[model samples]
Target: MKKFKYLFGPVPSRRFGLSLGVDLTPFKTCSFDCVFCQLGRTTNHTTERKEYVPMDGVCNELNEWLSTNGQADYITLAGSGEPTLHSRFGDVLEFIRTHTRIPAVLLTNGTLLDQPGVQEAAARAHIVKVSLSVWDTASYVNINHPHPNLKFDQLVEGLIQFRANFKGRLWMEVFLIDGMNSGPNDVKKIAQLARQINPDCIHLNTAVRPVHHDFVKPLTGEELNSLAPLFDPPAEVIPEFKTTRRPDFQTNEDTLLEMLRRRPCTSEQIAGALGLHLNEVSKYVGKLLRTNRIRKIRKDDNVYYCTVNK
Candidate 1:
């Protein structure tokens, strides 16, 4: 198979199925520095939108991949950063819609959803999923740590506006933390607010992978079940990660997973052991990390990877 710079996975997503991810922005370029982000801290925290990765490069890679008749459940616009930060993301979605039968999905933080341009571009996707975990500005700032320019009221207004106009499925996710936003008062307030926007489905999620801060904690299955009934339509918990690859889609990814299943290893250690280049190993490792198949841990100076159940 040809190596791709702009595309990764047929990642077995618990929500979106076999999702082929499109990366439009540089790493960690986002509007929020979320406390529970699995990819770690945001290096560039801003709402600035630009052609971070040129549209031509992304389209060229997509054209090549599509020409081979690659299959996926959804062509996802997401990666290490907020994809909407790329000014030309709608054009990419247009390309997918024009050329293929596969549906598109947009995963966004909902901070920029207030902007008309962002909302317009976001509508191109068949299903749009936005994050809303807090009830007020104080909780939003505490958990999401959004850009200074973003406001909670504007975000809610934008979401309500988008829901009125959007013809596609709009899914809202509320990420609950142990002591931060999972209490009866907080959850009840958030549930009340969620009813106003009125998404097609509400998904309750908790951190299952390694997070940016040690204090960030997850809610247990029982605890999550207890909180589900608070929403107007009642929320469903997000499931654990899984991937469905094609029959011809055998790669070093399988070997790496098997290797990590026995013991944890760093990226460098993985490359050396697998007889593969460090750069080549990163894509597969990232896919594994994103899907929650394997997790990273910091030990002294080195970070290591092991299966999530470990």
Candidate 2:
């Protein structure tokens, strides 16, 4: 298979099946350094929007991937960081729409939607999934740890305004932590806000991957079920998607290490990319870890292996 600079996967996704991810920002560049982020803490937390990745380069890669391996459920604008931070986000969505029939999806942190340009760009996607984890400034700071300039109220207002203008499917994700935003008062406040925004669906998510903070933990099935009815739009807990079939590509230590040298990836991501089984990927990862060629880091609730230097 041909290697792509900006394209990452046709990886199995629980929400959007077999998603082909398009990464628009540099690794870990985001507006919010959420405690439950799967890509680890945001290394460059900022609200500034720029052409972080060359738009032409991304389109070129997309063209190449479509020509060779066009099989994907959704061409997702999500990977290591928030996709909305890229200044040409709408243009990229346009490019995808012009070139292919596959529907585009934008996964955002919902902080930048206050900007007219950001909201306009985001409105182009077929599905816009915004994350609203907290209802107040204190909880926002505690959970998302956004850039200094962003306010919780501004984010909520943006969602409400965006929904008023957007014609596509709008899905809101609310990430819950055990002691942070799981109380009745917090859930009720979030429910009220959800009603105001009127998203098509409200997804209840908890930390299911390895988290940067040790205190963050996944809610049990019962706990998730109990919280589902708190919202007016009726929330559903995001379920884990599992697969037993092995992927098509062959993976070895050198190939896995070479890929890790580029960016850290979870065993599941590696498995999907290399077309190998998760257990098979783990064998090579274990060997790499023992040899000190790669190190393990916890983000969200998944363990990602990366080059030691990274």
Estimated TM-score for each candidate: 0.86, 0.82
| Residue 239's lDDT in candidate 1 | 73
For every candidate structure, what is the RMSD over all alpha carbons to the true structure, in angstroms? 4.0, 6.5
The Cα RMSD of model 2 versus the native structure comes to 6.5
lDDT of 1: 0.83
lDDT for 75 (candidate 2): 93
lDDT of 1 at 85: 92
Question: Model 1, 1-310: lDDT tens per residue?
Answer: 5657788765656678677888887777899999977666799999999999989999999888999988888999988789999998889988988989899999988777788998899899899999889999999999999999999999899999988888999999999999999998999999998999999999998876556576888888889999999998999987754433544334567888899999999877886796643433555675677677898788886668998987
lDDT of 1 at 12: 59
lDDT tens digits, residues 161-221, model 2? 9999999999999988898888878988998999999999999987665456778876776
- Model 1: per-residue Cα lDDT at residue 109: 85
Location of the lowest summed lDDT over 10 successive residues in candidate 2: 242-251
Quantify all predictions' global Cα lDDT against the true fold: 0.83, 0.82
Our model 1 lands, by Cα RMSD against the true structure, at 4.0
